[model samples]
Target: MFDSIQWLIGIIKSIRINDIIDILIVATIIYYLLKFIIGTRGWQILIGLFILLSIWLVAKILHLPTIEWIFDNLWSIGIFILIVVFQPEIRRGLAKLGERGLFRYSLISKKKAIDEIIRAATFLAERKIGALIVFERNIDLENYTEGCVKLNAEISLELLISIFIPQTPLHDGAVIIRDQEVVSARCFLPLTINPNIPKNIGTRHRAGIGISEETDAVALIVSEERGEISLAVDGKLFRDLDPLTLRKKLIEVLEIEKPDFIGKLKNKLFGKKKWKK
Candidate 1:
């Protein structure tokens, strides 16, 4: 044990600044890669791979040459298959890295995005146009973007309204907003499995609440039947909201400013009335 400790110390002593930086870069990449894998459809595939690895390790320890050989060959060919399967995720991650390095978001841009979304929501609600709008927060929604309309466009009232129009191709699914831009349109969301949800609550509202249940993202829904606006966060649905209340909820939930943050915190601490079911 003492010799092992000494050996580890010797290795640490030989580390240079560049070596530390290289390690940090690799660690960061791996961190993001794992994060991007979770909440994605490929998560189950990754778990299968891990199980296979465990089996291979056991085979090696047991001196089972045939099992080891099969696993080794499978891995040799399976690496390519993995790349093919995770191609969209890899491409999206690389693109995000490039964007993060190249672009920046100002508070003003976020404000504009909020204004546009509010205007669009109000328009849809008044017209009884069903809409599902999602605001991506700490959790990455890139997993849901695959096969959707990858707009990555500036959030505008006109564009948002157009996308949610009844006859439009992208009107059926949710629009995901990240930072000051719309990351995707027509992205399908998981439906809430909670039985407590009212039977009258349709798929749109269930999908909105479902996403909030899974991640920190906020969902806004426009009810076509009643022309009412609703907010879904943390698996709880807030119903019968006006344009002004919706804007306040967005500012508070997204934590765009200190004042809204304080208000959200206050509400949570005070145990205020929350709309649910």
Candidate 2:
């Protein structure tokens, strides 16, 4: 251990400023890469890989040649394994990186997005038009969005209402708004597999819960049958919320404000009402 420490100290002393800078750059890239994949399915896959590695190590220690050989072969094909297992995640990560600049610029214009969504939802609800709108958060939905009809238009109440008009081609599926733009319309989202979800919930609510379950996105649903507005976040549905309540909930969930007594009181009241129903 003493010799190892001496060698490490010598290596550190021998490193030049350029080498340190290069190391820092590489480390920063790795840090961000891990940050991007954290809490995702990719992280679960990584945990599985680690378990497999531990198993391989045990096999080697036990002199199990066949197991070691199989594990070694799998390790040799690591690149192919990554490609097959993480293609969608990789593409989504790249897309998110590309959009980072746009998102940063759009931060100044987020109020416009909030206003447009509120107006559109209010209009649709008043007209008894059912609409499913998803707002992207940290998790990228690029793969799902790719399967939809792309609409890179500025978000507006009129445009949103027009897209979800009955008999319209894009009226059947959910619309995705990202970076203050309508990224896609008619996007198919997953249906929730939660057995505990109430049987009274329809396909739209199920889809909203499903998408929110899989990603960190917020889903807004305006029900045509009941003309009630619902919000889904993290797979939980908050139904029959008014515009003010919905907006406040969204802002709170999205970390737009610090916690306050009034907000807490409102949430408590809302919780009780929901629980009673």
Candidate 3:
């Protein structure tokens, strides 16, 4: 017991600040990766992969030559296989990383953007015009904007409502907003493979949820069928939000103070708990 205690002390002493930081960074990455895959089909694939890796490890430890050879061959193609299998997740992670790290805007600008978005969504919802508007936060959405018509115009309630009007050329796809501007319209986003999404939800809703699932972007959907407004964030959908709640929620996301205040309180209470970005 004494020797074990000494060893523990030695191990604790050896852990430097840099080592702690390194461990924290790795832990954060793993945590986010798990969060990314959780509740999706990818989680099942991850479980299978983990089992295979464990079997390989056990076989190597037992000196099983045949099993070792098989696993070695499998590992040779593992990179390609993983890339193909996890393409969506990989794209999402990379998109998250490539964004300008600080997702901030002036208070006045943020309020204006939020008001414009609320106004547009209200207008679209009133007309029962299906609209999918993605508000890019920390995630740069340019990769998903390919083949979209580049507008790069200032946000306007008129333009937003007009874009989603039925029979319009750009009515089918999503509008991508970045830095308080509509950068593109008719942009295609990846469809989520999450099986839990309701079958009754149409492609527009799925795409909204999909883009939100894949990035830090906020997706606002105005359902043509129901004339209801919904918001998707981090793979979860909050359906049938009234204009007041929608405005408040958008402000909560765009404003730094509320998130920062909540984050600081969480850190003080829980210490390094996963705070929303």
lDDT of 1 by residue, 1-277 (tens): 9999999999999999999999999998888677777766667678988898999999999999999999889888897989998787778777877876624544356767898899998898999999999998877787788889989888899999999998889898999998888889999999999999999999999999999999999999999999999999999999999888888778878988655677679878996545443
User: How far off is residue 215 in model 2, in Å?
Assistant: 5.0
lDDT of 2 at 80: 95
Winner on lDDT (1 vs 3): 1
**Model 2 Cα lDDT, one tens digit per residue, 1-277:** 9999999999989999999899999998898888777766787798998899999999999999999999989899899998989886799888867966423665436666776788888888888999999988777677688679999888888899999999999999999987678999999999999999999999999999999999999899999988888899888898888878877776766666655898779778776223211
Which residue ranges in model 2 land beyond 4 Å of their true spot?
1-28, 38-44, 80-88, 95-104, 137-147, 152-154, 178-180, 190-202, 213-216, 256-277
Could you tell me the TM-score of candidate 2?
Answer: 0.68
Q: In terms of lDDT, which candidate is strongest?
A: 1
Reference-based TM-score of each model: 0.68, 0.68, 0.58
Stretches of candidate 3 off by over 4 Å are 1-108, 256-263, 266-277
Model 2 / residue 165 / CA error / Å:
1.8
Write model 3 residue lDDT over 157-226, tens digit each, in one string. Answer: 9999889888889888999987678889999889878999999989988998899888888899999999
